[model samples]
Structure formats: C-alpha cells, structure tokens
Target: MIRPVAVIGAGPYGLSTAAHLRARGIPVRVFGSPMVSWREHMRAGMLLKSTPVASNIDAPQPGHDLIDFCADTGERRYESDWDLVPVEIFARYGQWFADKLLPDLERVRVVSVDRAGAGRDGFELKLDSGEQFTARAVVVATGLSGLARLPRELAAATSDGLSATGPFSHAAQHRDVSRFAGQDVIVIGAGQSALENAVLMAEAGAASVRVVARSRGAVAFGDAPDRQSRLRPESPFGRAWSLYGLTYHATHVRRLPAPARHYLVRRVLGPLGAWWLRDRFTAGRIQVTDGRRVVRARVEDGRPVLTLSGGQGAGRELSADHVMAATGYRMDVAALGFLGHELRTALSVSRGAPRLDAGYGSSVPGLYFTGLAAAASFGPVMRFVCGTEYASPRVARAVEVR
Candidate 1:
C-alpha cells in the first residue's frame, strides 16, 4: 500500500504545502480547520499589516492567488501593496483557496503523532475522533499553538497556583476586546500586535489603555511610499531590498551559521506598526508608556499591579484591572505537544525549536515542520505568509525524492 503523506494544518503553510505535494502526484492527507487562528483568535475589524500583493497563500499552480480570489469573489481589488488588507478578507481568501485546491482536507484535530514502531519508517497519527492512520511522513504546520510567550513575572502573577487564568491574558487569547469595557488595561509590548490591541481595547470602550514597552522611543510606523516610490512594487512585508532578498533567498539564510541565522531572524523584521495605525494611537485614544518593561506583576484586590523599570525614568507602579501581554510567540518544539516522546527526542533542536535541513526536514527522516516552528532554521520569513512561497515547493520536492 502507498502510505499517504500527512499535512497537519490547514493554514497558509499547510494549504500551500498540500497543494505542492498533490501537484507532484504525492498522496497526501491534510488536517485542521482552515484559517482557524485567523477566524477565531484575531479580533474583528483588525487590518493585516501585510499589503494585498504580499498576502497570498502560495499555490503550486497559477490562478489561486489572493488577487484571483478577490476578482472571482467580487471583493474590492487592491491595486497596490499600500492598500491595507483586512483580516476578515484574508481569512475568506484562505477558505476559498482551501475549497479550490484542497477540498478533501480533513477538518479533524490530530491528537497525537508517534513513530509507527520499531523498524517502521513512518508515523502513526491518532485523531480526536478516535480515528487512526499511519503516514509515510508528517508535516507539522500547526501555526502558533502552545507558542504564546508570557513573561515569567506576568505568568507567575496571573497563576492561582493551578492555572494561568483570570485578570491576565495573552493578546492572542481574545477574539473580542469589548469584554474589557470600562476596565483599565495595561498592554505590554511595542510591536504591531501590542499597539494594535491597545487601540482596539480603547475603541471597544475600555476605561483606559496604556501601552508599555522596553523601547524608550515612541512606536515607529512603516513609511508610506511616495508615488514615485510605488513605481517599484513593494514586497509583501515592505519595500526594503533586504526584505525582498530575505523573502526570495531563504535558502541562503539557512546556510548561515546558527547564531547569525537566528540573529537575522530576530532583527530583520523587528517591531513596528503599519502606517495606517498611527492615527488611532494618538493621545486622545491611548497613552503609551514608552521605554518601560514590566519587571514584576502581582494581583492586588482582584487587579494586576505592574512594577516597571527601564528606559530613563525611576521605577514606577501601574495598576490595571487586567494585563494583556502581547509579548509574542516563542518557537519551542515541545509546543508541538502531539508529537510522541520518542519522536520529539529524536529531533535536534536550537533554542527549543526544531533544527531543520535544507528541505525543512527535522533530524528524524520523514518528519518535517514548517511555519513559525521552522523559523529557527529557515529565518524570519517563516513567520510570515510569504514564507510559503519558498517552503512549500522545496519541502514537496524533498518529500517526492524521498
């Protein structure tokens, strides 16, 4: 029997990889709800920082790009990268891509993935619905599951000795911010997610919202390109030549020394907000406590009190009804909790992320990872949708040859 290859996610990377594998005539099974994170975790009315042109889920063949979906669905067709794309629109486009290219994708959750057994060269996946199957290979494309980064201090404060629930939460935990209405919210982080969520909470009627970041300067915004500048098309991320090279030449990035590669991944696309978000973040809407980091947090009278120090000022205290840590994600291979002990033990890792080869394969043969989990090996491009353009076809080719 020809064992099927398993793709364990239905987001951009999973969909893109599945399309490439199928195009190569490789038998594949795909799992997970298409765009589940975008549809559920993201707040309503949020706009994508990425522009229209750079926001496509790469398909092996033509006619499945975001522009194609927009045209086919009669959605507003954006003419350039400067146009801000809405999260809802992007989620819809993903669903359309799945329908057109991978309609057979199974929408079940994978509960566990273990080695088939001694001398077996494949994996056995157990599904949430009590179904089980063995695949010749498994691609773990699960996006940010279990990877949300909560600071040690904030995490300790929020826990009741049992769970990290109540009064504190990660930015990715909310689909709606209105729940914080009339409450004081202390938003931590200076990145787009942190800035955007602070604005969102204030807009949702939060009594007060303040942004705290370790950087002393005000949050920076991406520059709007002049008409002359727009003549040269912008990369999906931005117009920087470095970004274009990073997006296109990811293989070169993988070849660099581990430290250099990791440093480039962290610094290349650092933190900033979209130009469009600036207007909403003015003093009238929100207050920003720049250059401060939360050194400690404790629950006081059913609220979160943060002791912050850094930047130029003396340490200070801020009390808020709730704390929102937009601290971002950390790629830990253990976060892929479905992997069995032996399989995870067999793979090599760097800073908790799987160490991947040129083909995005882990140390274990036939076991692969992509998307955010592949960032350590592939570079920061793996963190964005555009990474699929490089990862999908390359991984498919490797799998086909194997």
Candidate 2:
C-alpha cells in the first residue's frame, strides 16, 4: 500500500507544506482544525507584528498570497509595511487558503503518533475518532501545541492548587480579556504579547494593570522605514542587515556550532513591542515596573500575590486580583504528548527542541518538523509567518526525494 504523507497541523506551516506537496503531485493527508491556535488563543483586537507583504502562506503556484486573499475577499487590505495586519484577517486568509488549495484537509485530532511495528518503516497515527492510519512520512507542523511556558513561580502555585480557579492564567490561554474587568491584573514579561495584552486588559475595563519586567533598558519599538530609503528590505521581519541575514541564511545558521546558533535564535529577535502599540500603553494608564522579577507567587486573601525581587531590591510584594503570565513558550518534545513514547525517545534533542537537518527533518528519518517547532534548527525566522516561504518547499522537496 502506498501510504500518504501526513502533515499533522493545519496552520500556516501545515497549509503551506501541504500546498507544496500537492503541487509536487505527492499524495498528502493534512489533519487538525485550520488555524485553531490563532482563533482560540489570540485575543480579538491583536494585530500581527508582520506586514501584509511579509505575512503569507507560500504556495508553489502564484496568486495564493495574503494580498491575493485580501483582494479576493475585499478584507480591507494594507499597502504599506507600516500598516498593522489584524489577527482576524490573517485567520480568515488561512481558512480561505485551505479551502482553495487543500480541499481534502481532515479536521481531526491525531491522538498519538508512533513508529510502525516490527519490520515496518513508517508511522502509525491514532485518531480521536477511533480510527487508525499509516503514513509513509509524518510532518509534525504542530505550532506551539505543547510549548506554553508558565513561569516557575506560577507553575508551583498551580501545583499547590492555588490556580484551580480564576486567579492565574497564561497569555496564550485567553481569547478575551474582558473577563478581567473590574480587577487588578499583573502582566509579566517585556515582549509584544505581554505589553499588548496588558493594554487589552486595561481597555477591557480592568481596574488597574501593571507590567513587570526583568530588564531595566527602555522598551524599544520597531522603527518605521522611510519610503525613499535606498536600503531595501532583506526579509519580511525587518529591513536590518542582521534580520535579513537570519531570514535568508537560516540553513547556514543551522550548521553553526549549537551554542552560537541557539544564542542567536534567543537573542536576535529579543523582546520588544510594535511601534504602533507604544501610544496604547501610557504610563498614566498602566504602571510599568522594570528590573524586577517575580520570585514567588501565592494566593492570599482570595487574590494572587507575587513576591518581586531583582535590581530594585529584595522582597517586594505585589498583590493582584489575578496574574496574567505572558511568559513565552519553550520547546520541549516531552510536552508534545501526542507523540508516543517510542517516537519521542528516538529523536535527538537540544535545549528541549528537536535538532533538524537542512530539510527540517528530525534525527529520526522520515520524521520532520516545521514552524515554531523547527525554530531551534532553522533560526528565529521559523517563529514568524514569513518562515513558511523557506520551510514549506524545502521540506516538500526533501520528502519528495525520499
């Protein structure tokens, strides 16, 4: 039997990869809800950091880009990079991309993926609906599926049963912040998600919102490009030479020493908010506390209390009605509970992420990963929508050869 190649996600990476595979005339089966994370996890007023031109799910054929989708659907398109793309528009584009190019996508959950038994050399996928299937190759494009990183203090508080109710939640856990109305919210982190969500909480009628960060440096904003500037954009992420290098030479970056590569991935696109978001977050509206870290957290008087300590001093207590941990995700293969024990144990890992080769293939042959899951090997570009341009075709070509 000629088993189909399985793409285990339906987000940007999965849709892009499936489109390329189909264009190559390779039989493929895609599983999962289309754009599930963006639809469920992201709050309604959020805008993508990427520009409209840069945010596209690449297809082998022309005219399937985000611009094409906007033009076709008449969804208020933006012509300039400075214009912020809304999350809702992007989500709709994803669904439209799937409907147009991948009509056979299966909206089903892959309960587990395990290696085929005995002499077999493929994968066995068990679905949630009591069905089983075999695939010649499996591409795990599950972006941020099991990668939510809760802070140690917050995690410990949860373990002690302090967070069983509504006093604590992760940034990725909510699609609406209005529920936090009339309450005090402590938002932790310095990144875009942290800052943006803090503003959202305040706008949603939260009595007070405070942002805490470990860095004392001024929060930076991405500079808008001058229209007539001679220096052209190298990547969709930015016009900087460094960002350009990271985007185009991602595979080369992967070949560098692991330590150096990992450091670049973590630091190159470090925490910051969009230029447009600066005005929304004012000092008068939201309090900003820098150079502080939440060392401990506990429930006191039906509220979450955080013990802050760092550059400012030691043992500062901040009590809030709720804690919104905007701490970003950390990639750990073990967190991907969908992969069976045997498959998880077989692949080599570095820094809790799967180490991939040039084609985004894992240590296990015929097993591949893309999107955020492939960021460890490919560089930071994998974390953004633009990475699909490099990842989809490259992975498809690799699978075709095999």
Candidate 3:
C-alpha cells in the first residue's frame, strides 16, 4: 500500500501544500488547528501587517485568494493597497480555505516524528491522541510554534516564578489580556508586537503601558511609500528589487552564502509597526521609550520588576503588574520537540535552521520544511503568507507520489 503524505501543520503553508498535493491526486493527511497561530497566539482585533493582496494563502487553483474570500463572503473589502487586514478576518479566511479545500484536516497535534530506522521506507508519527502512523513524506509546516524567542533575562525571570503566566509573558501568550484591565504593564521590544500590544492592553483599560526598546534612538517603522516608484519594481514584501528576488526567485536565494541568507532573514521586513498603528500607538495612551533594554528582571510582590539599561533613564528600575517580551521568533529546528532527537540531529543545519534544496526539501530525504522554518533557506518571503505561492506548488511537486 502507498502510504499517505503527512503535513504536520494547518497554517497557510501547510494547507496550501496539502491542497497542491491533493490536486495531483497524492493522498495527504494534514494535522493541527487551522490558523492556530493567528487565532490563538495573536491578540484579537489586531491588524495584520500585510495588506489584503499580500495576505493571501496560495491555492492550487485560482479564485481561492483572500480577495475572493472577501468578495464571496461579502465581508468589508480591503481592496486598497494600504488597507490593513484584520487578524480575525484572516483567521476566518484560513478556516474557510480549509473547509473548502481540505475538509478532512485533522485537528490532532503531533507528539513526535521519528525515522522508522534502517531499511524502513518512511517515518513514524505519534499523535497526542495516542495514535501512531507512518507516512511516505512529512512536510513540517508548523508556523511559529515553539519558535517564540524570549530574551535571556526575561526567560530567567519568568522561570523564577510566573514563567509566562503570572507576571511575565511573551506577546503571543496573551490568551486573556482582559484580566489586565486595571494593571500597569511594561512591554519590551521595538517591533509591531511590542508597540501594538502595549496600546491594545492600554485600550483594554490597563492603567498604563510602557514600550521599551534597545535601539540607539526611536524605534523605526516601515511605513509604506507615499506612491509607487518606477525605479524599483514593487514586490509583495516591499518596493525593493531585492525583495522581488527574495519573494519570487528563491532559487537564486539558495545560491547566496548561508550567512547572507541568515542575515536577510533576520533583518528583512521585521521589528516595525504598521502605518495604521502609528497614530494609535503615539496617541499618549502608551509610552514609547526607545534606546533602552531590559537588562534584568525579577518578581516583586507578585509583580514584574524590570531593570533598564541605556538611554537617559540608565539604570532605572520599573515595576509593572505584567511584563511582556515581544522580542519576536528565532527559527531553531532543535526547538521542535515533536521531532525525535536522533531525527533532528540527522538533519543538516545552517545556524539553527535546516538547509533546504530548491524544492524546500531538507537534507533528509522526503522531509520538508516551509513557512518561518524555511525563512533562512528561502529568504524573507517564507516568513509571510504570500510565500505559499513560491513554496506550496514546489513542495507538492517535490513529494514523490507512488
């Protein structure tokens, strides 16, 4: 019997890949909650950084894009290039895509994935539900799970007690932020998560919110250009020729040195607030303090106390009811606890990310990675939803169907 292909996530990448594979009549099984990251990890009512056109999940056939979703569902259309996409709407879109294209998606989580051993044809998968199965191939499309990066100081402090529950939390860990209605909060990081969530909590009736960043000056925002320029062709990521190459021609990206790829992955299209968020964030509800970093953290009286370094407030100590580390994610394949240690160690890595061939295949045969995990290999585009266009079909084509 030909074993089915297993897709280990239900995010944009996983769903798109599964759709493409299914279109080729390749049997496939997809796992994980649809748009779990966007639905559970992100703050509700938040706006996505990408515009409507840029926020699409790829499909094997046309007419399944976000624009189509809005049109078909009669949702408020965000057709303008500058319109911000709502997180809730995008999450619903993911579910709609899955219902129409992958109605058989399994909501169960994978507990572990391991090589079947010498002479075995494929890999073994153990599920959280206690079911075990085998697959001809595994596409790891788990977007941003276990990849949240907390600073060493914040991590140590959280472990001291709260550990992302009581006093310290990651930006994505705000499952019920309404509980902080009357508490003072301190947010660390300069990115969209920090700036946006601080204002969100404040609007939710937090007593006060302070956003601190370690940059030398004010935090930077990648506001859209006033008008399109003919000098550089526009790309989904931005208006840079390099972004065009990164977004559409990942084959060329694989030719770059590993360090260059890693550098681009880390520095591209990140650590900034959307243009729509600037006014709300700077409206005096939240305090923005740049050029300072959280040097140390501890709990005092069941509250988080952070020590700051640099800026005019050098060595200042601040206490807040809650501390959020919005420092963003780092792709370390080893952090994927679902992979067996031996299987993980067997894969070739470049600076904690798995190196991939042009088709998104890892060093291990029949093992593939997409989305943020593929960022270091495929450039910055892999980190966003639109990358599914460049990645999904290729990964589907790469899977050898018996």
Output the number of the TM-score-best candidate.
2
lDDT per residue for candidate 1 within 216-322, as digits (tens), equals 78577777655325545456676667777788878888888899878887766667877888888874378888888788889888878899888666579999888
Give the alpha carbon lDDT tens digit for every residue of 1-402 in model 3. Answer: 778999999999999999999999999999999999888888887888887878989998998989888888998887677788889999999999999999999999999999876899889999999999899999999999888888888888854543445788888777556777888888888878888887788788899988888886556667565654668988875688888878888878889999898888877776778777877887746877777888899888887888989867589998988888888898898899999988899999988999998788998888999999898888889888999999999998889542
Distance (Å) between predicted and true CA of 121, model 3? 1.3
Backbone clash tally (model 2): 0
* Ranking, TM-score, top scorer first: 2, 1, 3
TM-score of every candidate relative to the true structure: 0.95, 0.96, 0.95
Over all chains combined, what TM-score does candidate 3 have?
0.95
- Which residue pairs clash in candidate 3? none
The order of the candidates by lDDT, greatest first, is 2, 1, 3
Question: Which stretch of 10 consecutive residues in model 1 shows the poorest summed lDDT?
Answer: 157-166
**lDDT at 288, model 1:** 83
Candidate 2 deviant stretches above 4 angstroms: 160-165, 227-233
Off by over 4 Å in 1: 161-165, 227-234
Model 3 whole-model lDDT (C-alpha atoms) = 0.86
Query: Which of the two, 1 or 3, has more TM-score?
Result: 1
Q: What are the per-residue Cα lDDT tens digits for candidate 2 across 76-160? A: 7766877888899899999999999999899999999999888998999999989998899999999987688888898887555
